[model samples]
Target: MNNARTSWLSRSPYWVLSMILHVAILGWLIWYGPVRNIMLERGKPKREALIRGKELEKVIEQMQRSVAEELEDRVTLLKNGQDRMATNFDTLNAHFQPFEENQKATALMRFEKYAAALKADQESLMQVLVQAKATKNFDIASKAGQEKVPVMISALDEVRRGVLLLSSDETIAQMHALAETALFKVEKPLRDIGSLLGRHRRLEREIQESKAQVKLLGSAMQASRDEHERVKKAYDELAAKRKAVLDQMQALRKVKPRNNDAINEANEVFKKLNEQYKTDRKPLSDANRKARDNKYQFDRVNKRLDECVKAFNGLNIQTKLPEYLQLAIDNLAEASALETQVIEQVLAATKDQADESASEVPAS
Candidate 1:
């Protein structure tokens, strides 16, 4: 038994050494391999998460800057448009200055002023849009979603209200008036020219009749010759009168209404009519002596008729005509149509803005 015990003790030392080495290797592996690897793997995910979070913050900041820039650009465009509209109104108002008639001219002036007002309203709308953009930016920047949306919605609502005011019928009426003024101012001169033309035609007919009378009288006696001379003298006097009338008509054609392109065109028509009068008058004045003698009485009547025709020709009828008159009507119709279109656009935009604003507001 003693001998066996001694041999087992001797082998125990080797077993102990083997166990110790195994434990040391296992400890080293836990400290430097799996445990450390597990810790490193866990920390890697945390570090990656932090980097991704920073990247997301940068992306959000870039988006905010882009949105802000876009908002600023849009606001600037809107302001520029408003300013242009104001300039247009100023031009239109200056055009109204030429009107001698108080009633019509005053109406036109009022309309132009209203157009200016509409432009102001447009500016107001732009301001509202700016406010909305600011609020939207606030909401986006605020990571807390609940607080941001409502503020943005309120700003949008303000924009809607501004748009609604601009689209009303009252605003449209002003636009219509502006157009009517332009149309009326244009047509006034045309009507005067038409009247002058009518006068010229009458004078031409009388001159023709006098010439025919001279032809019927065919050289007969000394008395007839003397009568023919008298007729010629009378015809000369009439020709002078006709020439004066034509000169006056020509002068009138050159007269331009201030700021009205349509009136300018009507004035041009008058110029042509005056030219026709001069051409027709020259022929009658240059007729043969025999014809003049035969047509002496007729020539005098014709001369008076020519004078009347020239007077009528100088007067513009389009301006003189009623509102419903088709031939010489002005741009009022077009202006009214444009006004309606603007109103409709404003209304639609306003409604859309309102809806969007409503959508943004949180439910009570």
Candidate 2:
């Protein structure tokens, strides 16, 4: 036994060494001395970083050069501007002189001559305006000085051959009297017509409202009929379920009393399994419905976006939107359209399933 222990102990060290050597080799292969591809990958990010750093340095140098050149240009411009301003100051002088008494008198004489010319121009312009009113075309250069109204007094008023000329105020007052006489003649009949038209409009609106009410009542009647049919169907289903329950009870009563408990338990288990199936599938159904609805909304929004893009394309491309946004939008819109078609196919395919679900009645 002592020799056996000694031999075993001697072999244990070799086994431990073998395990340690194997572990060390595995560690080296996995982590420390990995494959050549891994080693290459390890250095890839570092190489990229170094390349990016060099590119950034070049960009920085270019920016510095541009900034320095702009600064130099601006400084040269400032120097030139300062020199130009200095030259202007040295070369230029004010030429203005104050008015003398004789010059003022000469200006007054010139003003008088201008005033006479201006009066003649004003009269000519007034005649031109009257001519324009007659011809229905006003040319500013027209030199006609004809009066607008027949002008015996050489102005706005006319003098008839047999009577004293009526002033404009008297003519306006006479026109007012004529207008009053005409209004008195027609006012009552116009009022009666306006009242009749208003009543007609009111009756038309009432007729429209009545038609709307009648339509609403028709819809309500239809809804009530539908509700009645649904209720009647529900009652019939309840009666059928009750009859089935009674039949099941009769069959159970005919069985041995000991087996009745087992049968009832089996029925309870089946019912529970059905309920469980329903419960389990409820979330899946809800999730599917939500996904379908989300797809529908996505399609709608994307369709609207497509329309907007179509309109946007009509705008001036040189001034409106885009660098790459239109391309991205078009791709997304196309994808959305394909997805919508897929959803439509899915819905069409599952329509029978939906109908079956609606038709199925739960066991009572």
Candidate 3:
């Protein structure tokens, strides 16, 4: 019995060793594989996803900053432009006051007032833009379901309406005409003097010859001097008129255009005349010269007067006469352009910001 038990033990001994090895391996796996893996997972920071989220966060931050800076710059520009328009309105008002008192009031006076009001409105709109920027909540479309969206939309609508009201065609024409008339007034005297000088030369020459023939030389000499003095006086007066016109033109140029057509025309004319005046010739006719002087003076004055009449006749009623309707149109047009520019810029910046922000949002 002892020998049989020993034989069985010996045979089973290999199986026992194999079982022991298997158990040890299983224990090691539980300690260092499945259990260890669970521990590692619990301790891990989700580094890849966390890194991706952080990068997206930085991108969003950069987009916000870009939008903020752009809005700030736009607000600054609008404020400066509004201030300048306001100043121009004041200057225009002061300029028209004397005309009103003289009972020579043109539609221009009322137009200026309207223009001033329009500029004030623009300033107000700019203030709204500033407020919107400060809020950093310009997402009207996204916030449409919210109460704030309605308020924002309403504000924007009001601004649009105001702009439309200010930029009417009639108002634009009036402003253009006013500016052109002012410029024409400046050129009037110059034209008169030029013609007068030509006539004086002809008259003086004719008188000189007559004096030599009739022995009335002394009287002719005195008359020639008198004529010369008259011409000089007229020249001086015209020069003064030109200076006044130029001052007004400089002021007008600073004003915003209400209509492209009228403003552009006026600008072209103003520039042309201004250049012409710079090269204006002085009266060179000798008043003592015979026959030629008398004829020259007569012809020159007649030609100048004719030219003046023609120029005055050619003036556009819509632009030059200060008609109430025209002035109204111009004001409305200018306001519209200003508002449109502002709104477009604001929308574009906002859209760009939204796009960038969307791109930064992590994919689910």
Candidate 4:
């Protein structure tokens, strides 16, 4: 009997039994008065419980929506920041654009030409180093040249900047020294040029001021002439009026008895006018003399400016300047020679590497 029970129990589906037990528990809870009494003691009405459940669902939904909106705002801010970064990168790229082509051409023509051969040698050296590592050949692994080759080549490849295999810090320092020397050589000449330019500018400004002064004086002279003509016209009109009054008086005396008081008053007025005219004439003469003096001064200043300009134009700095620049040129030539020496060394090393590789190939 025990054996039969074990076989049946072993064949039974535990999932169906668990479902039946769960249903029985649920039925007991629904009909159980004690469970309902407990809920009532807790002060929760059945109808209010349903309403609270709906309210809780709404609050959860509101929370979810707020979280979603916050996330979306954060994403929008990130996207805008990313766009600004890209714009900044473009602006920075534009700022450096002028030098890019020349740099690329120089690298490609000079450094890149040797890069491929150097890379091949570096790879071969790395393989040798790996083999040596297994054999515990620390001597070969410790070789500075062999160890540096692979890492240096890999670094150059990662950066995509062409290699100058033989160039060393000393060579770069030498070039810098040469450049400094050239700058030192030309410094004095450059300062002299700057000083001359300043003087030339000051002279130009003075000439311009002189021209303005001449123009002002010419205008003043014209104004003085106009005033003199106006004074002369006024005096002529007064004299003519005096002559007409006298003639009228003479004619009236013949027709009737003369008015002596009118004649005497007219005579006195004419005398006064004549004296005033004479007084004004001296100023006219003074103005004419002053205008002539201004013209003479203008001419003298203009002549002086012309001579200064001629002297400045005739002066030659070219012969002296070339001597200064020639020193710089010589320094540049020396730097170039040093670079050429490095390039020759790299070429020779590359040739030796090629020959070694060729010899290492097996006869097939």
Candidate 5:
């Protein structure tokens, strides 16, 4: 029976072919996982586009910091200038009382002596200031560079002035001479303040007008900054998109070299991506250029604002002016009081002399 079956199977070609096909299918199923894993090991994965970003310009940030520090410096310097002015005025203020005389010399001699002292003090103070100025490194914020010498050379100037004016019965004549020559010392500056106020009013009007331009520039600068940020974000996105396209091109080059249709398709896609990248760059460049131009205009406006502020601060009338005016008033009041005393003494002396002369006349 076995021999009969074997003969039958050998005679059936279609049955043998069908068995071989079934065996081939089973072998393929068993080896599928290993073949796929081996191929994956041999072939590298396609490139992945990494995410990207950008930051604002460091130069701009640094310039902002520098401007802030410079403003602080200006404030400190202005304060120092005011302080120095107060110090000099205070020194002169203290020395105005003139009762320091030994009372030995004649009135003219004392006057000449006081004048010499005044000359000496003026020369000494000028020399001190000049020497400080000639120094190698002069910092205007410092006392030395500001010519605020600690020496008391000018401390006796007002004292000398008082001595020369109030030394004797010729006090009225001396006062008239001083008024004609020195114009009461503070009167000239007081007179000049009105003219200065006229200038200030005009400058104030200009400053008000300029402020509008400054505000406009400020708005423009802010808009430019916002646009720059938007453009930078979009530019980063575009860079990411271009990188993705580049990765696809690399993968296509590796996998589709033998396929003309796939290669042509990939080339066409790459060309489109490049063209789109260039087209997108136009807006980015425009945004950047606008931001740059706005920054320059902003700087100019800020500089003008600084100039206005400086001009406003330069008003001498604003620097402890009331105190100076009060000082001048006090000096005038003291002189008037001294004049009353002089007139009273002169009248008393004349009356006593008249009574003695009448007695001597004896019945005339």
Candidate 6:
């Protein structure tokens, strides 16, 4: 027995050493394997990140440059319009010179003052617009300046009509009528665009509100469903317990006759539990009704949101607005050109009349 025990002890050390070596190898693999992979990954060159960052910066710069160029182009177009209007005023001023010979000077002087004021207002608006564009905050400044443009145009229309009244030439009257008609036609589409913009804003707000209502109603519905499930589970558990009690009472009554009081008490408890279960049905029903009602409201809000989105998309202004604006520009240019021609014609007629009068006068 001692020889057997000594042989077992002699093998145990080898077994322990083998186990220790295996555990040490496992620990080393577990700890150092991931560290080696991480070191390798860290050693790899990060050229992609540097390249991507440079590309992103270039894209940002390009976007900024494009925005600046677009703003500058719009400003230049506005500036050209202002210059054209100024030229029209200059034409009116020249034509007024001969008209003033007949004491029709007050109207011309009033027009000149208004033109100067319009020019000053336009310059200030342009400066505000330029600064706003630089900061990417042109909402108020842009609208203010834009609103002023139409007012100035209306004033110009009045001045043009006033000048036309001073001239009696049929050709001048015809040209003025044509220019005024074209301008009126242009104004119609602009007013339509403004109305469409207002409607779009209102529809956007309605959609946002409807979406919020849908979210809130959905949450309420979920809560109601959860409460309904809880009430149903609790009632079911109580009913199950009452069933078990009734089963035990039946067995007890069959086995013993002296325990009638206990049986009666169990029956009473079962009756009460059955009544409680019946009462619990009302809460489950209420929860279900609440959930259904909330779901219905959520559906309604979702429908409203969908309708608003459809209306917003139907505006299609992105596709049609530029065309309308171009047409307006073309009409305005034609009107301005026609007005200039009428002014020149009126000036020539006035000059010719003065020459005829001078020729008919006797020498003093």
User: What do the candidate models score in CA lDDT, each in turn?
Assistant: 0.51, 0.46, 0.50, 0.58, 0.57, 0.70
Assess candidate 1 and give its TM-score to the true structure. 0.24
- Candidate 2: segments with Cα more than 4 A from true spot: 1-185, 188-192, 205-209, 212-220, 239-258, 261-364
What tens-digit string does per-residue lDDT give for candidate 5 at 1-364?
9999999988799888899999999989898846534444567789996544433466577889999999999999999999999888867755642332223224334444544554453344334334433552112212321232222224234333444444344654454344333324323333343355566777787788779888998899899989989988987887787777778767767873466677677778778877878888988899999999988988887788779878877865455344433443343344334433433443444456446756884332
> Per-residue alpha-carbon lDDT of model 1 for 234-330, expressed as tens digits?
6666666656656655665567744456456556655665565566554445444545454566555556656655655554433333321322222
TM-score for all predictions?
Answer: 0.24, 0.21, 0.18, 0.31, 0.37, 0.57
Off by over 4 Å in 3: 1-289, 316-364
Worst 10 residues of 5 by lDDT: 136-145
Judged by lDDT, which candidate is best?
A: 6
Stretches off by above 4 angstroms in model 6 are: 1-102, 105-165, 240-259, 362-364
Q: Better model by TM-score, 1 or 5?
A: 5
Per-residue lDDT, model 2, residue 354, is 48
The TM-score leader among the candidates is 6
lDDT, residue 3, candidate 6: 100
Candidate 4, after superposition: displacement of residue 350 in Å? Answer: 4.0
Once fitted onto the true fold, the runs of candidate 1 whose alpha carbons sit more than 4 angstroms away are: 1-166, 217-364
Rate residue 290 of model 6 by lDDT. Answer: 85
Candidate with more favorable, higher TM-score: 3 or 6: 6
If both were scored by lDDT, which would come out higher, candidate 3 or candidate 6? Answer: 6
Task: Return the TM-score for candidate 5, rounded to 2 decimals.
Answer: 0.37
Q: Number of backbone collisions per candidate, in order?
A: 35, 0, 43, 0, 0, 0
Colliding pairs, model 4 = none
**Model 4 ranges with Cα > 4 A deviation:** 1-266, 269-319, 352-364
